[model samples]
Target: MGATVVQLTESKKQIQHTHRTFDDQTKAFRSNPMPSISERRENLKRLKRLILTNQERLIEAIDRDFSCRSKDETLIAEVMPSIQCINYTLKHLDGWMKPSKRHVSMLFQPASNQVHYQPKGVVGIIVPWNYPLYLAVGPLVASLSAGNRSMIKMSEYTPHTSALFKEIIEGSFPGDLVSVITGEADVAADFSAQPFDHLLFTGSTSVGRLVMKAAAENLTPVTLELGGKSPAIVSPDVPMEDAAQRIAFGKAFNAGQTCVAPDYVLCPSDRVQAFVDEFRTRFSEMYPSIRDNDDYTAIINERQYARLQSYLDDARAKGAKIIEINPARENLGDGTRKIPLTLILNTTPDMKVMQDEIFGPLLPVVGYTNLDEAVHYINERPRPLALYFFGYDRGQQQYVVHQTHSGGMCINDALMHVAQDDLPFGGIGDSGMGHYHGKEGFLTFSHHRAIFTKQKFNSGQFVYPPHGTSLHKMIYKLFIR
Candidate 1:
């Protein structure tokens, strides 16, 4: 019990230290509230240079955390997007900073109106484990571009990457300018409880609720980037081979750990077998061997691996047809963390695989009789982070767009919409809320201040303070109509 008391005291000290650091950063923001455009650009350049110079080290650290994260996957999914976001912000930030003039009515002819974008103070970003680098840096790019200081809370799950990021940030910028915090769930809870100008969280919906609840204590505005069961629909007009390969790429990338990864596929009832065959073939071509394949990514840890295995077991016990796609026919249970990509057919709504967001490489293929059925099936559930439609028919695409609601949508492609610098990325309903990307991101972290100016001319003195004069009658007649 004495040892426990010592441990408790140490933990209390750690929490107090973190709180003090947050207060110091808040005070720093007060010291220099607004930074000039040149200063903001310089900060962004420093960040880009740091990442580019240490690209190899960051990749290795992430790989070590995940046990076997593909280096190419990190480059494509994390590094490339982060660098592109920085460059995109640099190219358009000047225009984004400029205020827009508004038209003033003739009645108020002497006055002019304009909306200026100003930075909110300090922002808090909560990073998730799956895509640690991109999720952390993505929001930082937006926060800095808007000229706001920020503090990032890295996930405890990815310790190697989190520790490395903290060190890199310390070396790159002052703690008050930008800081990184690393700790377990208790630390995260304390971090979220602190009052920030704005808070951005990217993780599961269940956890998002908890973060939001904590943020509510301070009435802090929040931007939630949560995940749900995103679906991929294959139109009857599209060929099975084309649809299957694209969908396979979306599901197989990151071993299906991405927030916007395709959770399931909706195939026409008559073409289910053909689609399945094509998907298996495409997955094999991409990864010939699962056990020893460098291209194939392993699940992050034993807990998640076991959870996915349990999902499969629960589905199989419910009489669903489970097809494991092991092209090399390797032993999956011999102490390897990598699980062969498996496809579950004949899934029911009652099955666990159909109920939860399948974050693993398991795909549940649902056969729908028509497009309306697929759309209805999706609409019946909570809105997803992304929805994919594979077809060239413009009418059908528009119909799907009008009929369904999601955070974002991709036509004839998968997972590419999030990469577009011009589009806003976010989720709706249970998936999440608020957008952060491109101009929307700038606006998300900015306060659009409305200003009005009037000339020294005195036109309103004619009707000043009189009960009902001829001028007042005339003015009322002219303007009130």
Candidate 2:
């Protein structure tokens, strides 16, 4: 999604305008022993049970906020991932918390070294509205697993879901270790300003920068999972039909509002039409009248709907073709705004769609003369949160993986990279910074301290004498070297 850009611009004032507040309760609830590893495991179990018991509430709240979030989507993207993370972390949390051993140097005989992974005190996680519960709880599943207290700040756009999450988390954990803060963007700025030991934010690149800047005041390490113009490169070798379906599936999921959603397609000049045709057919067969349908989710609000509309309007006014791929559609109003599923024959770098992250159901198909052009296009832009390559050629896939950088990548598919717990989920460069999930998340909130134990050995005592002897010079070279 683009970002609560306007909200951030007015964060200082809008925060005051909200009338909602989160400070009066901070100090009262801030006194608690930061959970130890064992305490954290037990607390995590409690949180898991709480989520399991309240799944319905989470789903219903998200559906209400989205206007129409698919139950299956909630289960797969939100509930299932969180459940999986909890399970994965629980199974390995103990091992993850153990201090690591290191070898001692012979030069300093009898000295031992160890790296202790300690939690970085309190953590701050800022969640976006698109997937409120998931964003709110997902990072906590990791931070808590790492034995750190966390404060979750949720989006104002999804007020219903944010409130429900606050209630859910409050019931499961003490407010000190796990407090949910909900208000406007100002709350986010204010919360970010707090002296958190660590901060994890999932949102737009613009806000990610501001979050990073605010956190810099405290020099708090930040994990910013932000968005950018992610490109799905269609290699020359992959089957057009298969690649199109997978890409379409990824783009269609969440109505293309996902952060890692393939923002645009980079294909060979000849195969561009074939890719678009198949994608159009696949999308229509999967969901029809999506704008008014209960299955397809509406844009979060009027402002976002207008933003997507503006992108299309700006591009079309600049002489670009816009096509609604789906045949079934209806009147859109009263929290309904349908957008073109596909835009074809548009390759200009200056077009509005080409220039921005199309978070809605907007896809721009850019034709590259060759593979180099496609790679060049991607490399020229800021490193994306995700990169999807559709190709069977191992060399080309490997080349793209090594040559260009992204938070993550999907081979022969799209948006599935984030699904893998083994792979680190995060961004590079301006897409955002830091990584999370599983070990990455644990390491993100941990301060690994290196310890060295030196023993008092009589063998080296001769080097410590005041006399300027030859042995002292030899020992100085030997020891200093």
Candidate 3:
């Protein structure tokens, strides 16, 4: 089968029509999708139940899609994040939905001002393969919580999970309320062109640009979660053993395939060897055996595996030292599909791996003069999706946090910043646009309608008759001043 999932056919036309039903009912939905804050909260409750009840199937499908994803990992990382996000919304949705109180000028003292949250109408969600279930459904929950009907375009890289999700959602939701579109490549291009009120996409930077351009045709707002080379700077103040364990755990989990995983590390030049020694010990403790091991998941497909291998070979050719972190005697054959746990040292900026986001089990260790050099080197690159620092000093942590803008950050840890539902999750500059999760997600999928109520007495009647010198003087003195 082609990378595209849906083709032009009778079946595809039916699916397309079904997915377009939300746009069809735009007028009715815009009027009453959720008239009150309580209703939006109830919708969140329903979606949370759906996720908790079906988590087993989600786990199974993810495993089938990616050779050996850990059930616990999926639940902890993806499922729990979504659940926590729902609870966060449920806890705060009412207050968010409540109109904000604005001060009225003395001239219009009788009137009131506030902003109301309105559904963005039809929402389009495009997901990627790495964590198909979570990435797909997480945005869907936000759309639904905002009281918008949705259509989801699953990643072509993860066919099995997409098919399963299609069955479940189609079986549960009315086409007009919620739908799934499983289509071939052109269909995604076509879907992107449709008139959606808003769109949210989670994928690589190149595809994110394409999705944005397509949405631009309709002036549809979009929340794009794009990727970049995220960096981790280890302050020499941190304890070696603790820092190594945390960094090792993040880089190797899911084969270092996470979007926000630290792409490389910077430490003092003299401390590089000590850091490596501690990381080596941590890897053994984390995963004693990884070959054909159910605990370690493979790259989504052979094409990606080859891409990763190409990066490794390119770095090796460029005079970078490659460190093998694999257990003794492992198979790289079809059954296991295992590549050795790999690390790189003595790397330079020109190396191919350094230039790109290494979304694989390859970690690079580079030396720097100190925190200043590390921060400067990262600043020179595209702002990252995430930044990691391993230190306990409050001033250093605050300095890095305030000085650099990332989608998010983790102090003394790696990648777990995403799990905290209270904080916003997203990127900056080339990393991508907009944010979601908790209140951010609700706000992303909503349109805050600015409303100003006027009392029986017209507040602006004095200036309305026409533009006069006296009125201009009153407006200038009362309003401008």
Name the candidate that leads on TM-score.
1
Global lDDT for candidate 2?
0.80
Which tens-of-lDDT digit does each residue in 269-323 have in candidate 3? 8889999899888987877778756777778888888888899899999998998
Q: Please give each candidate's TM-score.
A: 0.96, 0.91, 0.93
Q: Which stretches of candidate 2 lie over 4 Å from their true place?
A: 1-34, 333-335, 456-468, 472-481
The TM-score measured for candidate 1 stands at: 0.96
Q: Residue-wise lDDT of candidate 1 within 348-376, one digit each (tens)?
A: 98998999998989999999999999999
lDDT of 3 at 17: 75
101-170, model 2: which lDDT tens digit per residue? 9997665666679998877777788899878877877799888887777778888899888888888787
What is the full ranking by TM-score, best candidate first? 1, 3, 2
| Model 2, position 133: C-alpha lDDT score | 76
Clashes of 3: 4
In what order do the candidates fall by lDDT, top score first?
1, 3, 2
Cα lDDT for residue 139, candidate 1: 96
For each candidate, C-alpha RMSD in Å? 1.8, 4.4, 2.5
Off by over 4 Å in 3: 1-15, 22-39, 333-335, 464-475, 478-480
Scored by Cα lDDT, where does model 3 land? Answer: 0.82
Clashes of each: 0, 0, 4
Q: Pick the candidate with the highest lDDT.
A: 1
